[model samples]
Target chain A: MKVKQISVFLENKSGRLATVTRVLGDNGINIRALSIADTADFGILRLIVNDPDKAWQILKNNEFTVSETEIIAVQVPDKPGGLASILETLEKSKINIEYMYAFVGKSGENAVVVFRVEEIDRAITFLQENGIRLLTGKEVYTF
Target chain B: MWNREMETIPRPQLEKIQAERLRKTVERVYNNVPFYRRKLDAANIKPEDIQTVKDLERLPFTTKQDLRDNYPFGLFAVPREEVVRVHASSGTTGKMTVVGYTRNDIGTWSEVMARTLGCGNVTEKDIIQVAYGYGLFTGGLGAHYGAERVGAMVVPISGGNTKRQLQVMVDFNVTALACTPSYALYFTETAAEEGIDIRSLPLRVGFFGAEPWSHNMRKEIEEKMNIKAIDIYGLSEIIGPGVSSECLEQDGLHVWEDHFMVEIIDPNTGQVVPYGEKGELVFTCISKEALPLIRYRTRDISILYPDVCRCGRTHKRMNRVMGRTDDMLIIRGVNVFPSQIESVLLEIGETEPHYQLIVDREGNLDDLEIWVEVSEKIFSDEIKKMEELENKIKKEILSILGISARIKLVEPKTIARSEGKAKRVIDRRDVYTK
Candidate 1:
């Protein structure tokens, strides 16, 4: 499923992130979700965008390094044990979660959760084979 | 260590092998490369007369300009179809000069480079991270092929993106790196700024080349990176990064005499000086197939040592090059020459010949301040002429050379009076090092 996640190379410098974001704005690419994985010398900025290929193209053209990947986006009713149930299913399947993000749907009811799993295809297959509902690109993006 | 083909050859046998190769290379260049033949013809020397290594001096000297005039592949000894690879000097900033290699030439290059890396205790077990730029620039591919030939896992992380370079080093467990000394130093400094203790890194040795550096600066690098900083020397005009290298002894860089011949000659008298005497370094590529250069003037000032090393290798060694004899400067490890800046000014058509190259080492790096003469042609007396001239020269010089230069508009005749070969370079790095 399509996920709105941002991946950026994290340079520890404060303004370096700004340079990447400024580039997105200048090129008119909007960031839907963003997080950073960091080491001392660099950090990977993970991002899901409105235009994945164009966002990547804009960054690469400006000499900004970018890596693209697919992930699983699951929608759940905003109730108790919502995150716990998804976690138990992924945990049982032995799928490692590198990073994940959660947000409320614009309609203000269903919960949208994005996960950058270690094994993407297998993660989706396990969820599909287990009767867990997954969000499509249009559903995740529009919500 | 397994490929002991040329390195393990006995000294006397190596000499004989070189002599045979030298004579053939002389004859081959005379027959195939018209440029070398014309140069030999003008000097009244026949290729047949040069039978021994001693007779090599009798041939005329080849120079950088010769490479430029015979631009691209004119100097190649073989047909274009036989050539497997081409590497060029960024003579892109000057008149471009190119060099080519056959399959055999590339093998010899890799062997010599492996030997250079071997000097630093590198082996097949080490992962080599190549940070030098690839493509036409020889620094990247030169190091890349050699590391691969030596059986090391290589990271072809060509220059730029400091963050990615650091991440790759950590993520891949890269143990060695190759780049311009300047950039490597910059990487170390950037790492520190980010709270990265350099001692925590995996890099153990760095092969820095394509620029001039000092022993004192070498100490600084060794301290900063907590790794051995090995100096590797090469120019695209003369093979690539395998030309010569300094072993752990750090006494002098050992030149691969089996493939190339080395001589130091007095520039004024054009006479070969005895061993240990300082003079311009020259080379004759005895084993090069695509371009067998003969007595090519490197314009680098250095001396050679013929003694066998404690490391048990018998290859000849060259003292670390002091500096270039031409319009070259080592400001903070950057090769700054007047021609590079002059080209930019020429493109704009408002600069004059009167320019002083001012170089100094700051806090931890070298800085260049170009004191250029402001010609009235581009500036109207109505403006603050000096300020406008300063901005113009600064912008153009920075654009040409990625390094910034402090442009000071000195009034005509303000750059101290020089009588002889104009003292264009006033280096202040030496004082700071002391």
Candidate 2:
């Protein structure tokens, strides 16, 4: 299953992160999950949002460099070996993950793990065939 | 002195030779070159009418556009067989300003270069390294011939390769260096970085030219490299790197009056100015055969001191070239036109037209950073995409300008817009200069 994520480019100036979030918040767009990749010169803010298309539009209107990327969200058992098991399966299948982040689901027994990989369709087919639960975009957004 | 008789020749005798050479040069150009013949005819002046250096004012002035109009070989006075060498400068509009030299002309250049190197006290005992770039540019070979003429051990180690340049300077015990003043300072920094003690090296004299530098830069170079930094001035169109040079006195560069007739004219009015007045420097190549340029306007702004120098040279001297009437930036001895930068940006189609070039001196080296505005569509949130665009723009600029620059992409509206002509460059190094 694939989910839509919005990313914004921010120059490493003071209050740039605040500016990006303020722009999205002012447009009534809620950020569900977020991660930041930063360097000395600039930073990239990635967000799983309620409406990624609306978020991209509002950020673009605010003159922020924003893009939409397709990522997969997997349901884990919230155990110590949950992420390790999924990673092992992906490794065996020769699927490389670009980046990953996690959030605990409302059920408290499972976790939602977001992944960015180059081959989304192959990873989806492999993971589904391996009996790994892949949340749909609608389910991830609602969660 | 390389040639004591010529260096200290009396003013009257020098002027006499200048007058005779000027007459011969004008007569040759009038009969051979159609461009000069037309120019002289349009000015209603004949070659016989030019008997003295003072009579040169009556002739029509030649601009760089005239050279471009002539193109590759349109202004040569001699046949193609007699021409020995050719040099060119990057043209403003993508065509080169080409110049040629005959055997005798090369001899004249070498002679002037000998005098120039001799001014820096380069003797037969000294080991000289010519660090100026060789090829179609006049810097390297010009210094090479001059160093050889002085009977010095010449090392034809052209430009770049900082590590090798330093190693050669140490291993060969180089006593003299001929390169751009900025590069000499850059070498000093690199030597220090490599744990080499440049001050302990045998570098006694440094002949630096091909770009305008300040007296403070002279001090920096001398103290850092422990060498006597001498300023040498010339252009490819006007016989390359040995037109004039500062003697030991370091007051002004002595223009060998016997070969070149120098004049100062107000750039705005195009009229001759009094001696010691600041104006555009013009030269008439009295001894040049292949390219006998007459009243060729050198856009460099400086004053002329015809008085004899304290170093006992009776040749007329010109002050250091300070500013230019036009916008030509000399970055690390490379000629960079702002229009070239604009053309590269337009060709890449990644950035907006609004850009600013920030030039600064970082640790005695010239640092160039170009601030280009990116269109909203091209600005990518992905780090790899953004870095790719930056590298692409940098490669394009380097290929077009032949100079490296740090590419900085800013927001579209960050650069201030102008109502008239845009302000393209912010030179922070001007504070060190007058």
Candidate 3:
């Protein structure tokens, strides 16, 4: 139920984000989802790629500061209350959400929401016990 | 003038005094300082061979490294008991370039400073505010004693505390301000930010030194502060910030010929250059008691104006220092060397020695930013890890350079590599200073 996410440190200079994308694209690594945490001086480009290990090796070889982190992807109903219902359940269980981003599934009627939480195992257990469908690493990587 | 008899002494009389004092200083150092004696002996020159100031060329030139080799008190001529004071500057290596002062040396420093303040028209009635840092740096006490020597009421404010500096400048009716040129401009900006019009203050004269500044900067300070800014020159290896100063003429700094024997030498060849020609400014301290430097190479680039000044002072004047022959950067009046930064980076063993220093001036203040290449291990992609490394590097730089910097962790191989001498410092302040 855990997916691997890679984050790259970037100085807040023009063309840096473009460079990161080009590096990943040149290596045939497709980014499935991404987010950026930024400040006036610098930014962190977090990416979920189809091949995280290969992407990590390529970026590291290119002298990019890259690290791997474990994140969870939960499939929620494509309806309006999908994300809100899962958030309400997690909030009830007192599992804090550090950060989250979502993408619509390619063929399924459900949407995949990636989440970073305080406790990985506890969050996975709570979501599974609550009848929430969790996407595995391979499923999320291809989807 | 503070001392009319000496300040305006005729050229013939000045040379006679310089020659006489030069002989005595060489003898004192050759007898008292083992380092000087060994250097002279290695060069096959005896103290008796140096009969006049012109004979100083025969002596070995002392470098800042020599001072560090004799760390703490190795180069001091007088015994520890007679040494009354000590001042030091951070060396490129871990050691410090230290200088000691006897009671009489301190008195001589005060006397030269008195003449410095006098050049700024600071008299007994003037309320002088000394903002140069005190302590181990020669700037603070050097200016302080000079103000006291002339019977001026001194506001020993040292440095920093911008709000208090402005308040006291107004409340005490400060007439003369003594500090580094950068600090003076920084004060102006801070005062403007505080909505305090510093130009309207009672300040009339400014003595700026301890760093190389340009004529344009002088004009800016004078215009902004509504005061006359005089340039004062000195180094810790020499006697702090009172080695020389500008008179009302503002043409060049008048080296106290009675105390110091000035020489302009070609930095590349170590040969003496003609008067009025640009070269490295060198000095031989004739009056210092504890530390008698012999033909000490200052590494500061400038020319000596032996011609008479319009102010009628016959002491030889040196043109404002244009730049340095070495890779020393003066940021906020503190000397920073790239080697110093490289050593710190190497010692930390976190980042590669590949780094670039970007120095620019913002708001009339010098801003330094160092770009260090992040190795794969240190750049864990975690913001917290990178931030901790950045903080560690910043702290080390601050502790060593005595000036804060903005540290940017760059991707490896981002900094350009030069084919020859690696380009380390990219100083952008020269345009503004010029």
Computed on C-alphas against the true complex, the DockQ of each candidate is 0.01, 0.25, 0.37
lDDT values of the candidates? 0.77, 0.86, 0.88
Candidate 2 per-residue C-alpha lDDT over B1-434 given as tens digits, one digit per residue, 9 for 90 to 100: 89889999998888889889989999999999999999889988989999877798888888888999999999999999999899987776567789999999889999999999889878899999999999888999999998888899999989999899999999999999999888898898899899999999988999999988988889989898888899999987789988999998999999977888899999988899999899999988999999989988988898999888999999989999978877778887777777777877777664547688888888767888988766655665456777877888789777766678998876545666678455888887772255
lDDT, candidate 1, B124-181, per-residue tens: 8999999888887788999988898888899998988887887788788878989877
Residue B18, candidate 1: Cα error in Å is 0.3
Question: How high is each candidate's TM-score?
Answer: 0.69, 0.80, 0.86
- Candidate with best TM-score: 3
Ranking by DockQ: 3, 2, 1
Docking class of 2: acceptable
Global Cα lDDT for candidate 1: 0.77
List residue ranges in candidate 1 displaced over 4 A: A1-143, B330-335, B362-366, B381-406, B420-422, B431-434
lDDT of 2: 0.86
By summed lDDT, which 10 consecutive residues of candidate 1 chain B come out lowest? B377-386
What's chain A's TM-score in each predicted model?
Answer: 0.87, 0.95, 0.96
On lDDT, the candidate that comes out on top is 3
Model 1: per-residue Cα lDDT at residue B298: 86
Error of 3 at A109 (Å): 8.2
Q: Which residue pairs of candidate 2 clash?
A: none
Q: What is the TM-score (0 to 1) of candidate 2?
A: 0.80
B239 in model 1: Cα distance from truth in Å? 0.6
